[model samples]
Target: MAVGARLTPDVLELDPAAATDRIVAELRTIVGKTLRRRGAVLGISGGIDSSVTCALCARAFGPERVLGVLAPETDSETETLRLSHVVVSTFGVPYVVENITPILAAARCYERRDETVRELVPAFTSGWKLKVVLPDVVGNDLYRVLFLVVESPDGRQERHRLTAEQSLAIVAATNFKQRTRKMIEYYHADRLNYAVAGTPNRLEYDQGFFVKNGDGAADVKPIAHLYKTQVYRLAEYLGVPEEIRVRPPTTDTYSLPQSQEEFFFSLPYQKLDLCLYAHNHGLRAEAVADAVELSVADVERVFRDIEQKRRTTRSLHMSSRLVEPVAEIDLSDA
Candidate 1:
């Protein structure tokens, strides 16, 4: 996928009020059609996406019928839980916290100490050169340090060596937390006879910055169509807590709560979106920079990142052979 394909500003320029109206209408239709006999279940992540989703759900189906699940892992921040509560209270919805820490801990302990590393080595070594392995490891560690320092002012350097096995184990453990939350979401949604509502925005979705089956699992997405800025607008409209709206967005996966911009790329969402828009319209990198009021080098860098992400997304979707084609079936004959 070229940067010029999906980053058009025209496509990104959506009318906020119309979009909200459309979202609310579509959500109501989805709930009416899918959960007419029961109700709707939404995994509330306490982020803008989920907050906006909860507000829309409350407006569409009423708070009583919309159940909010706070599926936090052991490492999830206290803020996540607090924000989840704020959303529930604001919407006056029934909420529950199903801590998956026990499940994750059990899963981690169930496997042998080196199991994950043993499994990952083959995949890692397949295309990796033996000579570059140590360097790659060092580079990753350095990047982690930089990330930590940026997110946490008090982060200290603690030299710790890791075997390849240990490194892989750490990676797997972090990934498990995300997958476990999704499992809980699925199970609870089924048990409660409600739809699983995914909380991903257009920016993340377009960037393909989500775990496919993990946080991406949802039956209905109330905020998927909105961009980050647009979500903020909706959040304000819905009276989301001031802290939540103002605080930087983070995944809170690591020890430090890293902002999405810091982890992804340093480019602000508005500028990134504008650059993307120019690029998607077949503008050259220099032209995009000029159009978006960014440096030429910055534009080039963002364009490259966008291109890379598009490729990764395409590879993931195509590899799974899960690209559902648009159907143009006609019922006139019937």
Candidate 2:
């Protein structure tokens, strides 16, 4: 299956308002049933989804009780930090900024400075080859390769490597950052007797767009059902900063300032989500194109992607199983 299959839709007809309302009601129940206090803890990335989640948390539990944690990696952009602060201030909630550079540095040192590069040796023939060199102090611990590709043009071949440590440092660095934030948030939540709020929306969740045990870990999720578009609407309703609501969403993991849509789908989120919704709900590709006013070819492409994602997600789900259940369980005569 292709990389972004999980993000495409089999059908394209989710009721955003109904989904948002249902999630809000569920969030309220979680606040009342799970949280002993009025405030909640959420990681605010300054993106629309997190901002919307934080806003909803504040609305449900009160602004004073909601604590927003801004966990920025060393390579995080200034704009992200600014937006995070904006959201926190808008809601009148307490906020904290924690940098995780030191932890990443330590992890790099433990793994050795040139681990990824060294691992690249087997993939290359024993000949003149190019490799990315790292500083001695950071070694291998500070850098991680996100992908390695061999490209050839007119018989001139080159191997290119992308590193999560340096190029996409925010990815690895921020994964730990998020996990650490959760740990701290959990501590604060325990002390304050509140719930730790999750900030992922349905778009991200359907795409499996989070680190499994990192940002995906949450005690309560305030905006899990809303799609990307619906989150923007709610953000407007809740008075989120205009800059944040209008800005394209980015993970801010790399120096290039890449958004999730650019990195994953190579299309705008608005277009991608619409295509996904139509395809996922069993709409004919032509019909979807008509509904969204997109080209038929585009809709067909999205259809193919959705089918791939369904197969891939199913495989992943099966592979993650730790124990095999009985192949056949007798249910008769129970």
Candidate 3:
């Protein structure tokens, strides 16, 4: 930025071609030279982040060395499988489909989650669908809280405020899905001696949106520094499938369709990106209000929420504590 340059949405833009080359080069160094791994392995979710990651990995370590794993479970949307296939096929990468439903079922993931849901809505049963959502932070001044939504067999729906214990129980059970998928990813990586790639964008990475030791576990994350909006830019440059580029961001963890905004983030991704940028740059809420098309107060609310999430999720980024420091050897080529 130059002196007196305006701060608008343009500030977040970057040269997609340059970014692609830089990321591919860096991934080569990290995955090949530093990690000393044969290639890369990653789970493709058919989402923008994962799709872009697959494309970058293919460029970094040819399509033969890049393996895309499609791990779908019972609750996953029908399109998840199709879109995941589209991503791998577009990149011309060899992939294996790992159905994780049996693993989750063996762990009683659904059983525990349903038991918790039934505590709130007794009618929630085998034929019911369930999802958890947070209130609109920018549109409402109320405290941030989780609400449980369940649809009965005949299409009747109901929403209820979740008790603290119930929320923890539900989340704990659902976390099995992510951790289970990560286990499968590592299994293939270990067998092939490949590095595991993580696909969290700047928003999810910075805001602690991933499950620890689950989706958060990775050998290298190529897009952790790119915003969701910027990820879209790189997607186009990488020639990611058009269908994935146009698809809305989703959680895909719940039975019912759920947008990332309703599940966690306070605003739509584009607006949230601008607000996050302004917040990171120390720009006043009033300064970015018009750019993000939100009131100053709303921007302030979002800023507060950002900080709150950071404070709460700080532990998620930590390593195991030691009684004292221990020197470790470096094995990478100099």
The lDDT of each candidate is 0.65, 0.63, 0.92
Q: Pick the candidate with the highest TM-score.
A: 3
Candidate 1 is scored at a TM of 0.73
RMSD of each: 8.0, 10.1, 1.8
lDDT per residue for candidate 1 within 1-334, as digits (tens), equals: 3544333344455566777678878887776764552556778777877888888887777788888988876557888898889889989989889988788778863243224433434332212211001221111323222211211133333223355556545545566766777887777677877777778887777777676677766677777657676787778877888877887777776544556776564566767767656656677776555545666666776777677678867643332443664468543442
Clashing pairs in 1: 4-280, 9-277, 196-219
Per-residue error for 79 in candidate 1, Å, reads 1.8
- Model 2 agreement with the true structure over 133-188: per-residue lDDT tens digits: 22321112242233433222333344446655543443443466556667777777
Which regions of candidate 2 deviate over 4 angstroms? 1-24, 34-38, 109-174, 290-294, 310-334
Model 3 lDDT, residue 309, Cα: 94
Candidate 1 worst ten-residue window by lDDT: 130-139
